[model samples]
Target: MNRSALTARGTPRRRMSVEQRREQIMDAARDLAVTEGFHAATLERIAQACGITKTLIYQQFGNLSGLLLAMVEREFARAAAGFTAARQRPPQPGQSGFAAGVAGVLEAVDAAPATWRMILLPSQGGPPELYERLDEARRLTREALVADLLAADPALASLTNPDHEAAIALLHAMSEELVRLRLSDPAAFTVERLLAQAEWLAKAMFGRRG
Candidate 1:
């Protein structure tokens, strides 16, 4: 048999390009970390999941910490890019820019449920490093959303820094909870359902009834 079919132990290994190999490794690591918790996603476990050697994984990602960082950064970048694009778009008629930005985020989550779930609903007992990075990403996202809101409606410009911070904190908390609910109980918290609630919240917060 050819080498591709000649493995003695298990499924035959197939050669992959560098990018393909890295993608495989990262995908395996993310699945393990999200389902079983980050600590459970040890080097050996990740390697086994990818049907590759630990050394191979190390070559691609340096170490366990490096792997975790890569996963976080990749996932967070996808999320950040979506929000950034939404914020930069011109407002639709009668639609608050904040609402449009939120719609963009919801659309992204709908498109890539796994990525958002990994970033939003981190596994219990996940690594501190993962949480630290996740928290920072979340903080930045909230700030960007708040900035978009302020830009869209300059009427709220008189608010002090303390008020702005408090408002953003509330918005962040609500968004996080909504994300968790949407993932865990999709039947009850469908995107449309959550977006409707979000619209109400946004209107109440911004006094932008149409």
Candidate 2:
């Protein structure tokens, strides 16, 4: 075997590439941000969390702001994908789509409350680029929801002017409202209660049949 190949196999293989390594760094940053607030996430801290060097982080992301932007973007995408997936879990024969979707969202939110909080409420010290990336992510999330809606209700297409933008706004609002609830009462954010509330709200919002 070549020296490189041997080295690749000699030590435990790193599960991620350079780009993915950066992602791991950001994931750690996100965890810190959620738990300790954005201001508390530092290069040394992130490097230590990833068991890598600050130099590696600097190589991938220019500085702290760069890291924050990456973390923000990644967190948004993770939440969006997770919630979408949870909403789509296969039902047991006759489960309501609305209920399933609501449960999925709640599950996703539970999966990463800290990350969701950061996205829903970008606080002081967050980078400008983070805001831009989040804006894009928000738009993408909205687009995904619009597609889901159009697919579920083809008859609605005849309306000619479905307020997709409004729907997105409402969804964002609902997400933030939930975030506020969590902030108001950490105990109330328990997975089961939050999911039940989300299920009820989603059913009412979508007019889903029982």
Off by over 4 Å in 2: 1-24, 44-53, 90-96, 154-172, 179-186, 202-210
Would you estimate the TM-scores of all the predictions?
A: 0.82, 0.63
- Candidate 1's residue-wise lDDT over 1-210, tens digit each? 565575667677567899998888888878887777777888998888877789998788889888878877787788778767756777568766665666677777778787888888788766577678887887787777777776776777553333666776787788778777877888888777887787777666656324
Q: Which digits, one per residue and each the tens of the lDDT, describe model 2 over residues 1-210?
A: 345434454864545778778778888888887777778798888899998889988889999888787677677778778877965775435444444555566667666777777776666666777677767876776666666656656654344345645754686567557656765576857655665665565445555334
Q: Rate the local accuracy (lDDT) of all candidates.
A: 0.76, 0.68
The per-residue C-alpha lDDT of model 2 at residue 170 equals: 82
Residue 88 lDDT (model 1): 72
Q: What are the root-mean-square deviations of the candidates from the true structure over C-alphas? A: 3.9, 6.3
